[model samples]
Target chain A: MTDRWDLSTRLIEPAPDLLVAQPGRIVELAGMAGMGLTRIGYRMLSEASRRSPMAVVDVRGWASPAAAWEAGIDRDNLVIVRCAESSTWGQLVAALCEGVPTVYAEVPSAVRDRDLRRLAALIRARQVRVVLRPLRGELPGGIAHLRIRAVGVVWEGAEVGHGRLTHRRLVLEASGKGAAGMVRQIEVEDAGEDAVHVVSGVVSRASGRAG
Target chain B: MWFPAWSLGRPDAPAEGAVLVVDTKAGVVACSGVDSDVGPGMPRRQAEALCPDATVLIRDIGEEARRFEPVVCQVEELIPRVEVIEPGKLLIPVTGAVKYYGGEPEVVELLQGKMTAAGHDVRLGLADGPFAAEWAARIAEPGTPLVIEDTRRFLSTLDVGTLSGHDDIVSVFRWLGVTTLGSLADLPREAIASRFGAEGLDVHRLAHGQDRVVGPRPIPPELAVEATYEDPLESLDQLAFAAKATAARLMVGLHREGMSPFRVTTELEAADGTVRSRVWRSMSPFSESALADRVWWQARAWVDTGVIPGGVVRIRLDPSDLSGAGRQLGMFEDVMSQVEAERAFARAQAIVGPEAVLQAQPQGGRLPTEQVDWRQWGEPESKPERSTDDPWPGATPSPAPALIPPRPTRFEVEWEGGIPTRVRLGTRWEPVTTWAGPWRLTGRWWRDEESVDRYQIVTSAGAFLCTVGSDGTFLAGIYD
Candidate 1:
């Protein structure tokens, strides 16, 4: 069956390592600041805009232009809307329902439960993917379809003889229906000057794909 | 129209970070895709520190004009006459071409399509005069055209800061709490002239859209078309059917005159002689069908609201601000779609601020951060003075960092014989298994601006880019 989040095209192209959620599906990336959640979001947003015209409603102006550039979002194709107040969930809902293919928002954590429910309902009704990157706190229940929990860097590998921590192995735990109890090994390496490529290794199929 | 960051849109290596373009005499000549806090005329070092991932390039006057040649050439092909305000901005007079094109929107759409195909993206603005047109273009999103229907109302909403070439007048206006053009125009023209002199009056006239070209142009009397109904019309559908022929005839008259109107002032007269009218503006040339649609929508809204005192007996379509003829019906669908996409993006820009949309151009710099420059979309591209061909000594060797923190993250490093034995990535500390370099990248020690002892270290947890500067050891970039 086609995914409900498949309202249109996927924002970030699905990678062997990175799981690109379907349209309208909320994937919660639970990690600390340095765990690279923002990078994943940028990657997804950039890819989505490249495939189709998209917009970003930056609630707190959190989307970095530099990161967005690295993600390869064409400025011509992308529209960025910035709002300061958490009370602006109404605007966020409006944007979600708009015809734009993707609308990524950094929903502030201080937002009340009622607003979140309203936003969730809008997302469900519109059937459009709205990537919400909360700055803090766990994502409220009944919103996220998949949750990727960062388990920190598991191993730092040195270039055989080079002795520099050039390659790193990050441990991420996937929890959901099909992906539940599955542990995946992902590799992140500095691709020189300023590009980060996340290479995903084999999943130890403690379980099959999320049902 | 105003090209916001013209220099950064160069054909060379496209830069894609916060970019600051500077000249020796002017310091920061232009900036694009940067935060508002960073602006023109800022010193180089401070700008870099403020936006650490920013790329700083000296301005190249010769190359900028050289590259701009194609844009000028493309525009010249469409209108025969174009005034180059600067490298990134151009103005084309449409008074003579409107009749040929059928409408202002059509002409702009053609030019935009042609120029874009020719590899020069431009923003278009239509107004009574060059000053307002340029402002409209500047405010318009890149790759889109902004049509000004009411110059006075539009100008009134603009900040006085939009008045270029009158910095002194602007400063004084700020001091007087006169922020918008409307407020400034409210003051007596004589008072402004007596105090600020002829220059002030020039600015005042510009604000009011009464600039040098406003009243000089003469329009033919036969450009307008009207229809009279024998019986009063009570419904919108009937009113629209009656206006259809009139709209078509108006377009034909405009076409015969070798011009296309950008704005149409439609008037409806009721049987009781009560009249209602509204002016509609289109960014691209309006076809007969499109014009009819607009009229239908207008009449429907009015009739639905009971704004008409009685059934409509008369309808008039008056077209003005003509330009060259618009797109032929058989034009490629892809080209039209591209134009439509541009128009949509421009509408989005109206919702979001202008700075949200950005374009990237590459520039020569040693650091990865310095390699690319980002500028607001449709802004004038800045040319870099320093050639990328030059060997940038002491520049960080590639592959560049995947991520450059806006500010260097300070890290505590235990040094052993000048090599980091232990370091921190975030909260956790790990033993340094191996490492490389204490590459001494010391430069501008004379100015006390930057001096660094750079090293690449690998730990059990992750890799770190460690730099020891006057401040302390800090993490600069990440590899993975």
Candidate 2:
């Protein structure tokens, strides 16, 4: 765990004025919790920010784009946490307990022991935003956050509604400005809890409001 | 087409038996047979051509791996010190197994017996080196044995083609005038290795009786139970029962081995002749009952939702992320049930009548009578939070009625504005006891009709109920 007095520099990309000069790179996040958290180690120094607030930027050094994003962490201004293959789960976890946000990102399925404990600590923290990617299969159980993508309908005027409600077919190049590494066309659909239940009319109306 | 034994024929030996090895994209899939004869060639295609009536199965390498699985389990069962060389192969240090079984021949007999009991016919060969034993197995006839002490003389009599044994490698050795194992070993080991790389030296070392021991096979995480049916499983129930039995056996096996599986993977071989696979995970060190339940539930879930189609023949269990003890548990059924239920319910509702169902929901309001309503299932906004903490305004503390009228009642006001002294009940005159101010439940203002104002009231009979003023007072519902 880190002392509150420890100063952390965050790296941000074309971000908030306070975030721009920070020591971390700000990448646009598309999905919810789990998948997003795995990116802290490669993109941001979420692991480093735990022992100390110091970090580095080396996305190009990563073999996998997701790994780069995992390194570009949160909590300490999304600094890149460089870790060797020998890095133990305990180290990343200490950073997570220190309020590191992306510590939960990209947990290997083979994770065990200390890594599992670190995951528990991060989940208990609850303040760290989770990363989300659309599950290729039926959504896995115990997912705290759900993100869905689908191609929506085009209007009579060919004007695609630009809102969380409308999902469109966006052709993402293998290499692009907003590429999520995958070259497939992802239907950018509505995400979050409310979007999932809105059309079902499950939400209760305010007493005074007419239905 | 299934198991055909006719593929084991030799060129000179009449086609009395078969040993078929089919080349796959990555590796080889082999099966042996004694009755049906295969002409000389790769046992697979040649056997198919020879025995048209044979069970011509496209060998599943996975099945071969599964078949080989018991060997590992058997060796580990008897000889505590055995090293695994992939799924179907293993290397024993021999010092221990030979010592324990009294001799290498007895150990070989025990191994052969176990494999035979498991429905396999195995050839036993013992030599100082792993390669020599392997080659001896190829050359040995069924039921005969080879002892490690006589390995030098036995190996010398063997053809040099037995060194690599692979057709391509054997042909090369044969072309170089190498006729016997003794002759191949006579060449300089260094020169042979540099020319043919490490394989040549390995063959030479094996040809001579060199022994370099490796450790015994490490025990699997826990009990891994698998089953292969002689016939395809037709019904989901049978498949589930098989899965449960297999899981139970696997658990017993693990317990006997003094280990526990942290995670369990139960693979269901498709029963309907279709290769459908389903895997289920356990929350804890799953017991037979727990694992069986999961397997049965998963099978039923698949059946109900049509996740897997027609037929299946086998199931495998591979428990990964192994730990001896103190494995962390994640909820299995809670999550599994939700997924299962969603799919099952949707399918059931799809087949039956969606409009036939209804959900009784409590409507929150000041009036105790207006606290509940009914909505058809699948319609929007069916239920809301209705708790006792919030009290209704007009309705008395009396219990509310059950039935609701299709429309509300309209009252003529005797007093100045909205409050009425006299109100007409559903077809008769009645006086209001505990009257609450009217709360309008209005909707679709764009349309002329379908507007409402609900009121809470406690009748003089101490009944707490709600009635709306649309036309005339009709008993809606009573609070219980």
Using all chains and alpha carbons, the TM-scores for the candidates as numbered come to 0.47, 0.29
The C-alpha lDDT values of all candidates are 0.61, 0.40
For each candidate, the DockQ is 0.07, 0.02
The Cα error of candidate 2 at residue A95, in Å, is 29
In candidate 1, what are the lDDT values of residues A1-211, reduced to their tens digit?
1121121231222244245545766666776544555555555556566555555556644344444555566645555555555665555445434545556666677788777777677666756555666667767776666666665553233442243333333445566532443444333433221344444333443433432
TM-score of model number 2, chain B: 0.37
User: B1-480, model 2: which lDDT tens digit per residue?
Assistant: 011232222133234344345432211244445233443234354455665544433444333433444455456788764543323445555778778889777787787777667665456667766666665665656656555567766677778755433455667888988878778778898888887764566567656766222224365644466688777766865775676566656655655554445445546656555443333332234554455555555455445445456655677766542442322223431332222222222222222333322233445554333454434333333224455456644332222222223344233323325554444443554444334535455545676645455444432222223444445555443221
Q: Which stretches of candidate 1 lie over 4 Å from their true place?
A: A1-18, A54-99, A103-108, A124-130, A152-169, A177-201, A207-211, B1-361, B377-403, B407-409, B421-436, B445-448, B456-466, B478-480
Q: Which ten residues in a row have the lowest lDDT in candidate 1 chain B?
A: B329-338
Candidate 1 lDDT tens digits, B235-271: 7558756666677677667665545565687788888
Residue B121 local lDDT, model 1? 51
Q: How good is the docking of model 2, as DockQ?
A: 0.02
Q: Which ten residues in a row have the lowest lDDT in candidate 2 chain B?
A: B1-10
lDDT of 2 at A92: 41
Fnat of each prediction?
0.11, 0.00
